[model samples]
Target: MGAVTRLFELAAGADRLGLAVTRIGLVVVLVWIGGLKVYHYEADGIAPFVANSPVMSFFYADPANYKAHMNPEGAVVPANRAWHEMNRTYPFALGLGSVIVLYGLLIALHPVLPQAATVGSFLVAVMSVVTLSFLVTTPECWVPDRGGPEHGFPLLSGAGRLVVKDAIMAGAALVTMADSAKAFLRRRARRTPAEVPSAGAVAA
Candidate 1:
């Protein structure tokens, strides 16, 4: 019985630690990717996804001309400059990067301002779902070649593989949101006299 009790306690401890680690992992990913979006190469790489997205296509000034400027090799060209300037790419990227960074910072502030963290987690969840949708909406997600490596349905191109990883982020965001929400509720409950059980109820 003692050994069993000890083992259960250890498992509980590990579960608590796992939640912290998950939050940290998500923060790292959001901050890193968000930071990269500020760069021209990363912004160019994502042009296809944004250009094809019905929800986001308006962000580009010339969505029709996106292909003419984007190089599959990720090279910077004269066309790239014109496309970026005309499309307002830099300002858009900077805005997105700022939002992402704020989310990470808010998550890290969980101990001090849990309400903010809860909001951040919710935002992360929403963003993750949008990103994962790219797998279906973006044609570049799957391998184009007929006989190429991992071609077709179950297989993804390099860009597709990257987008697919958003599934994990979505899951993580949900977990973080649940945790933060529970904490917030608990704190609220503590402050509410109505939530406290009477002595008779406790005895019962």
Candidate 2:
């Protein structure tokens, strides 16, 4: 095979590995965030996004809160309420986002689902891109330093891990996209008829 063709084949083979890796990551994230939501259900210090914007509230905010605040009970609130809601609902947002991420990964892993892996990689790519914004906006999310004066495992810390993790996923997504495109092109080329020159043209 040509070098380029071999590269495309390698890319095509990456789907299985990428899906497996991404599935594990998604599971870890979901379990972690789900645990967080279970522990931190209260909305204290949260920004009340569900209670403010009508359109934006449905995504990750509590549906009840969204319904409650969508109509408003009395006075008009400030415009920055959305930001506040974002802060207050941060844990919930993470929890819900993790669930969706996990679901996408699961779907990707299912062989019955055609193009599941490619679709999952695309979804993960979107999450990775969004993680960039989250990292920029909340550097504190990358908690550093380990063990302190007590435990001695020196476990890894910080949201910075996510930076590396997501970047890898994005690269995998690119590979999957390339592989899919090549496969599609190859299939189309096979279906197409080979062109034949006219007798007069061949004689020339």
Candidate 3:
């Protein structure tokens, strides 16, 4: 084959490997972030998000009172700790982390359980949607209105930047889901007969 032809051939055939790498990236992100959710600091950091979420505010004991009892990362305040305990922040973080780890493991087992991996991929996409919604629901995502010209809808804060990354995660999950679904269909095709007897053939 010509050198150019060979290059094209290699690129064309690398789709599977590319997806495998994407799967690895997804697993690493899910597991690493999920594991972090178990820490007190991590739970405290998410307080603003959960407190502001329309769907998730119920997770806090008093979402309206969250700001007054906020704990800065790594800071130990007895009153804030007690409030968080009452709010179930630590317990919720642990549970969320466990689910994330489980999702990563499911994706990792694709070689043996593509079905589970497909489900996990779907969940990942759904979760990413929820994460992205924070940009709309959480005020912390936008620069605060501190009398600065750079504080408004188009101005994203650090939390906003982080939430925006979920769009990429959602896309990756969809690509993996599509690949898994194709594999499932191919397997099903193999299990069925190669051909069914036609009505004309039976009549003949």
**lDDT, candidates in the order shown:** 0.84, 0.50, 0.89
TM-scores of the models, in the order given: 0.84, 0.41, 0.88
Off by over 4 Å in 3: 1-13, 193-203
- Give me the displacement of residue 137 in model 2, in angstroms: 0.8
lDDT of 3 at 51: 88
Error at 112, model 3, angstroms: 1.1
Report each candidate's C-alpha RMSD, comma-separated, in the order given: 4.5, 11.5, 2.7
Name the better of 2 and 3 by lDDT.
3
Question: Mind giving the per-residue lDDT tens digits that candidate 1 earns over 27-123?
Answer: 8888888898888777787888888888988988887777778755567687777778788777778788888988988887777777888889889
**What residue pairs are clashing in model 1?**
none
Question: How would you encode candidate 2's per-residue C-alpha lDDT over 1-204 as one tens digit per residue?
Answer: 599999999999997787557555654654454445432332322223233334444555354443333313233444334533644455555565566556455434534433555565566567557654444443233454465553212222343454446666566565654454455566668979999999999999
Question: Which one is best on TM-score?
Answer: 3
lDDT of 1 at 158: 88
Most accurate candidate by lDDT: 3
